[model samples]
Every structure is written in structure tokens, then in C-alpha cells.
Target: MIFIDYLENVELISCGFDHNFSITNKGEIYSWGLNSCGQLGLGDERNRNTPCLVSFPNDDLIDIRIKDIVAGNYHSIFLFENGQLWGFGSNRDGELGLGDKNNRSNLTKIPIENVQKIACSKFHLFSLAHDGSSYYAWGSTKYGNWLSSRKLDGQPASFSAASAMILESPITFGLTSKIKVFQFQEPISTKSIIRLFNNPDNYDVKFVIGDRRILACKCYLKSVSDYYCLMFSGAWKEKVEVEIRDYSYETYYAYLRMLHYGCIGINQNRITQLIDLATCYIDKRLMKHCKTFIRDDLDEQTMPTYLPLVIKYEIKELYDKLSHITIEQVLPKVTDSILQNNENSIEFLDWFYNQRRPFIPK
Candidate 1:
């Protein structure tokens, strides 16, 4: 039963690539297997033939109503009810960030409070707290830099032998005074973000710093509907005029909810009709996420396989990041010997460099 659970209360189960698993119910975290580098918090360097309890200090006062669990390449993390975090199994590279390289013999308490989410990486962890702040990287290289730069912690990301580029965390421009929060997931349009500051549609767009008291009612909506409500998002010093028809409202609401939750509650038969009717405006972030989900999750044979074609149809904010460069970098290194008096060969590099600057007319 080395890989099988013998624990009676093991109500849920999940296993990962390295044959590691985190099993729990209330708030308790348990694991077994491949303790070679101490990925299992079972103390000794021996592998357990069955699951064992990975205890927490607060276990005495709580039933371990753990909110969530995730596994990485050689590590694991779980969220708790008290907003605290707990992790064990693999402390190498300080991914466990207890400020030590020693294996955490059992479930060790990570004093990160008010955590709303625990994002586990191959050897590191990411914790997003309730106050809209984030914490991460008690493990691994790439995840650490990504997490550090996420909080605007100032260390520029470094290129490593592992050769992966971590994306920057979303940046928030500090507000001078009280104002509304405008948030959007990835599929959102560049147009919407700009609309918050100034509407290009030729209308006078403005916000007022009223009462000097910030109204911190933050709402980050997923679908197009919440953005729809943004028509009333401005600070009003006078009466406002807005018009939204019934069909538009229902369609936006349904599309918005679907994009947010990965589920739509609208009538199944009318979904096609809704998609067809709601063509005028769409949240760009929603459209992108849908395309990504389709590409990654769907098989390659899927006709509308947006995932496989994502890189092809991708729009890069910085064109250099459009794709990994092989020939572009290598071509510069190629000597004139390879170009030996061939006029056609000389023209090739000129055309290639010009191609790299994507702004010009193709």
C-alpha cells in the first residue's frame, strides 16, 4: 500500500507527476512517498508505506477546515481557514522559505495570514492575501523572481540556465485620492483600460476627488457585464444619462458570468443564439482566456484549436516577446565566411533584422 491510502479519513485524493499527493478533509494535510530529498514531511529519510498525518501547531484548536490543496514538481501547499498557510515535503532551495534548507519534518506553519489563495509552483508557493497584496517564493528559482517582482519588490527578473521568462505581476498605479477600482482579467481589451482614464469616443470623461474619503468598494469582474456597469463607475457631480436595452443586458450578463465561472446558466439551446447576438462588443480578456482554455485543454484535432494556433495569431505588446528567438540571435553570430561573397546571403540578414521590427508595413 506504498502508493495507496490506508487512512480512514482520507476523503479526498490528488496525486502529481513526482508521485506525491496531498490528502485532506477538514483542515489536515497528509502526504506519502519519495522522501529522498525530503519532499514528504514525514521526518525521517525513509519512505512511508502508507499515508500519515502531517500535523499543524493549530491542529489543537481547529478541525483543519483547509480551503484548498496543490502539488508541485516536488513540493506541496495548502490553504487554511485561519488565513494561515501550511507546507511541507521538499524544503530544498528555500522554497519552503522558513529561511532554512532543512527538511520540515512535518507540516510547518507559514505565518502568512489573510491568505485568499495558495498558488503552488514546482518548488515554490504563491499566496495572495485578502487585502489585495501577494506573497510567494519559499522555494524554486523562477517562481521566486516572479513572486518577488510581483509585489513590486524591485529585483529585475534574471535570465537563467533553465531558460524561462516569468511574466510580470499586474502593476497598480497609486491613487492620489479616493477613487473607484477598475479591474479586468487577461481577456480584457486595451480599450477598456484606457476608457477608465479618458474615453476616446469623443465624450468628456472625468472623475472627482470627493469627500477626501476613498470609497474602496473594489470589484474585479470577469465577464463583460461588470464592465457594462462601469457606465455608472465615474464620480458623479451631476445627473447622468445612460441607456441599455433588455436584450443587451441579458446577453452581456450571461456571457460575462460564463467567462468568469467557466460555466453559463443560460438556457442550453439558446447559447448559440446568444453568442450570435452578442457580437457588437466583447471583453478582450474574456475572449483571450476562452481561446487559451480551448487551445490548452482541447485536443489538437479540435478544428477551432485556438491553443495550437495561439502563438501564430498572438498579438505581442513587445514584438520581441512574440516568440522565442533562435535564428534572430544566431544570425547575428554567423560570420561573413558563411556569407562568402554571396550578395543574396547579405540581403538575407538585412531582411531578417527588418522583420524583427514588426512596426513597419509588411
Candidate 2:
């Protein structure tokens, strides 16, 4: 194992496939390892076995305090505390966000400002705006084409058909509305509460899903959900084992986990089912979480699939928000064959067409 003894008070470190970079608490950046692509940002293509300080151009007036750093396969991006962004290294794919496909050995300032955070892959870069809503992306257009589907400044996003050309500069996308940040209430003690979840030792009830049986606590379940409170109080109080139907084991377990641990492990695949369960149980917290995911992360590709759910579940907030989407904007992303295969997608298309019919000219 290599030990970096010379550096002190290291605040952050990011590594690429062959190179690495570290930032000190005093805002000093040190880099080492491979330099074949100048990812070291040391102003030369020389590999370093020891850490070397990365310097900025003398003309820069802002202080060089880095808030975050990310190293791509052949590039490095730095986000400054004052919201300025800088990058270096390979530009063959335009990952540097410099508006040109020229490699830079030294740090170069990116044109866009008010950057709060940055993330990168092998040949692309993504930056989050200071407002925590809009996202800016650059680098390979192969992946960046997703941005073309979104409406920018109330206008449909347009892009060239040429896939060979890279997105040399950052382009903004995602929801225009300010993102709603949800703060989950901290549990009294996470470890102990989490231990009680699915633990057979002191479980008073067992919910059977298919052939599998899941252990749970009655008192804790009752405390978190009114459905559990009502079920455990009346004629069903003596029930020790209950058979669950309709929902899968994973979805049910995630629901129980939320009630016990105050959070759920959710993804796109399971979000729809979880939302249905939340709606059936009248769980406002889970409903809000589901709505937030749809509202903030909704894109043209997913709008077709999710629009039906938004309407079916009566998610007024998202329904109203998605009403702005035009049929022309989403129809191109989905073909008639794909739509015919899905009844929900067909339903959404019909509903969306009628909603926009008044605006379309005869």
C-alpha cells in the first residue's frame, strides 16, 4: 500500500483509472500518478511518483479554494467555493468543457458559472447549478442526446444529428422549478432501531409474502402507520401471522423498512408499486417521497411511462406540473409500436393529445 505521508489535513481525494488528485484543507491541490493524458494537471505530460501542487493562472482574481473535485478517466474537474469551475487534461472527447477539443496540461477556466457540484464519467461531465435544480452537461454527445429531449427556457431543446461532434460546452437541462429538498427526521438511534427491523428475536408479528415470512414488531408498526394502528387494535389484535397479497416481498419489506428506519431503498422500477401501496395506506410521507422523485427526475423518455401513473394516482402536484409538456415534445422519443405494447402509454398519449388539441392549428 502506498502511504502519502507528506500531505497534511487532506480534505478530499478523487481518483481516475490511472491518476489521482487530492485537496488539502488549506485549499492546496496535489496530484500524482499517470500523466499520459495530462490528467495530473501539472502543466506537462510527466508521471509523478510524489505529489505535485497544481497551480492556477495568475490572471484569475478569485481565490483558489476548491469545494469539490472529480477525476474522469482522462480529465479532472474542479469546483471552486465561489462557484467558478475549472478543468484540465484530455479534450479529445471535450470532457474539459472548454468549447474545443484541444487537450490542456494546465488548469483552464470553464465558461459557465454558479456551479455547486460536479460529476464525471470516462468521457463526459455533469455539473449541478447553485440553485440545486438545473443541471449542466458536456463532453460526449452520445449520452448528452438525452438533454436534447428536454425543454429549455420553455422551448424544445434542439441538437445536431451528427454524433461525431462532441458537446464542447455545458448545456443546461432538468426541471426549471426549484427542487424540493426533503430532510428526513433523524432517528433517536439508527443502529438499535434498524436492528429491530426483520429481527426474529422480539418480533410479535410475521407477515407472509409467498413462501417467505418476514418478522416485524407490532408496537413499532402501529406507532408509524395508522393502517397498522387500526389493524392491531380491533378484532385483528390477536393475529400473529398475516398473509400479504398483491404486493411483492421486496416492496413490502421496503415499506416496513421505511416505517421502522425512516427511509426506503427506492428506484425507478419499484417506485410505481411503492406509490400505489403508499396511496392505498394513505401514507403521506411515502407519497411525498414518490412525488418528489417523479417531479424532479421526470424526463421526456420517462414522461410517457410516468404520466399515466401521475394521472391514475391523482398526484395533483405532478399532474399540474406535467401539464406543460406538449405531445410533440414526447411523442418522438417513443414509437407507435412501443406505445401499442403498453396500454398505459396509449392512455397517456390520448389524454396528452386532447389536452394540447386547442393549441394546435387546423
Candidate 3:
């Protein structure tokens, strides 16, 4: 029998069936067990009975810091602090999200970022973004569609054709699906990158926004967005230069930061502007953040300003939160004339009565 006596002074962070993974205090990943599909990341598909050090590729090996490990039946996923995701092992069903069904024997970095958690079940993989607003998956078609249905909670969602499917739902009420488009960012030093924006060392695309420029890798865009994927991946494509006119530099940069950092800081001052941009870009996470900020910061004085926004955006959670506060704090102080004059106030009153009125006693 093989013994893993060398695993001393190390903490077992997580484990999976027929495989074991651990992280040292210094944040190094070690794997053991089934390697039929190179799930051990050992550069080969041979199973090992003892723990072995999983090697990462040298080209992208700079500042290699792993934050989490997720293992499926015959595959493994690694998440890095710099919003990078690496996968190894079976891709028979495209569980690695590599846009194909080719099994990887070596550590292959996939084009995705800001992934908070990756749930690997029997044959399904689900990824949740750090912003708590988006979920992604690429696995069995049945599983992906099944989870999408669960996310919709009986609501309908539109299906689109992409390596990884994104189920678009209605954009109103609490039923709106919160989703995001992720991108890739390397941890390489600035000196290594050829340009700040235009065709940066390894980047494939550039977007010009007035005086400012944003550099990006096209892999994720092709997998996530329908427009760009169709444009660049076409057989007739020759050049790639995109002019972004829908969003200002500040808003555009903010969205980029969300892709790189997993979360972006936003203040109440820029909430409305960011919300508009998020809506235009179909960035539901940022939209949700804006609504959450407006809802959490609401009070008696700011009620008029934010309530209309809540109603307009159909943010049922925030609407209910503000409604509860209004019932307890604002309603008693309101005069009959104000309710009679304001349409929103009247609607609120009607809903409030319906909620507060008790049914027949049992």
C-alpha cells in the first residue's frame, strides 16, 4: 500500500472522489489518486497511488498563486487570485469550458475570470462569480439546461448557441437573471506586456474609447458574448478593432476592473450612471450592485429618489426592503393629500394594505 507520510504540516483544503487535493500554508497545490484523464495535473494520464506535486506550465508561471481547487469525477480546476482559471483532465463532455471536447493532459488555463466558486457534481460543473450575481456552466447539455431551469425558478429563459450556454431571461422584477461576461487578465509584469492597449504582448483585441484605450484577450469574449464571438471567429475575419461608443471611459474601465478583480468598488454618487451602463452592456452583476447600493442606502428623505428607481428597475428584493421600511417609518407620517396626489405612493399604499390585512382566522 502507498503511504502519503510526506503530507505532514499541510492542511487538506478539499477533496473529491478517487482523488485528493491539499494546499500548503504557503498556497501550493498537491494532488493524488486517479490520473486517467490527467486529473492530477502531472503532465500525464497515468494514475498514481501516492500524492504528487502538480506542475503548472512555465510560460505563464509568473506569480503563480492558487486560491482554490475544485475536482469533478475525472477533472480538476484551479482558481488563482488574479482571476485566472486552470483546468486539467477529461473534456469528453466539455466540462473544462475550453470551447471544445479535447482532454487536457497538462495544465491548460481557460479564458475566464472573477470566478468565486466552482461546484463540480457527478457530471455537471457550475461556477459562481465573486459578485454573487452570475452563474456559468459548461458540461452535459442536460445538466447545464437543468441548472439553468433551477436558476430561473419556473421562469422562462432564452437559449443561445455558444460553447458555454448563457440563458437570457426577462429583465424586470425579481425574476431577472443576474449574469456577467468574464474576461482574462495575466499576472505578468507591465514590462513584459508589449503595449498598454494596442495588441498588448499576448492580447488579441483592443477597444478604443475616446482618449482612453482598453486592452483585452479575445478568448473569453468569443466564448461569452454572441456579437464579438460571431464577428471575430468568422471565416472571413481579417482585422479586429472595436470602437466602443455606448459607454464612457469611466464606466467602461469600471466594467473591465470587474472582470480583472472580480469585484469593483462603487459609491452612491455613480450608482445611476453605472446602472445605465450595466444595463446597456447586459452586465447584471453591476446592475444588481447598483440596486443593492440604492436599496441599502435608502431612508425617509431618499425614498422619493430611490423608490422610483426600484420600481423602474423592477428590483423586487430592494423594493420589498424599502417597502417594509416605508410601512414602519414613512407611512404614518404621510398626509392623505400626498398619497392621493402621488401615483407611486398610492400604489405603495394599495400593496401595503394587501400585505398587512389579515386573512380569516383558522
Tens digits of per-residue lDDT for model 3, 234-265: 84155555678877777677666455434444
Candidate 3's clash total is 0
Per-candidate TM-scores read 0.37, 0.48, 0.40
Per-residue alpha-carbon lDDT of candidate 1 for residues 1-362, written as tens digits (9 for 90 to 100): 13322332333444533534544334455676666655566665677656667655655436547655555556555666567666665665554556666656567766556765444444223222221233333344434522121232432221110122232333211101111111233324343342332233433322222311111111323123544345445432132323334344444444543433333322223333343433334445444434433332222122232222445445243234222232333343355435665776677779878889768575
**Per-model lDDT:** 0.41, 0.66, 0.58
**Per-prediction CA RMSD (Å):** 20.2, 11.7, 21.4
In model 1, the number of clashes is: 18
CA lDDT of 339 in candidate 1?
63
- What is the C-alpha lDDT profile of model 2 across 1-362, one tens digit per residue? 13233665454566665777776656788899889878888999999988899887786634657666777777887877778878888877566767677888988887777765455654334222232334455665545533211212322222211112234544332211211223245532266776777997879899999999889888887887898899899745999998989789988987887666554545556778888998888898888878877775565536776888888987788765565554454444455646567876777789879998777576
Q: Which one is best on TM-score?
A: 2
Worst 10 residues of 3 by lDDT: 172-181
Instruction: Tell me the RMSD of model 2 versus the true structure.
Output: 11.7
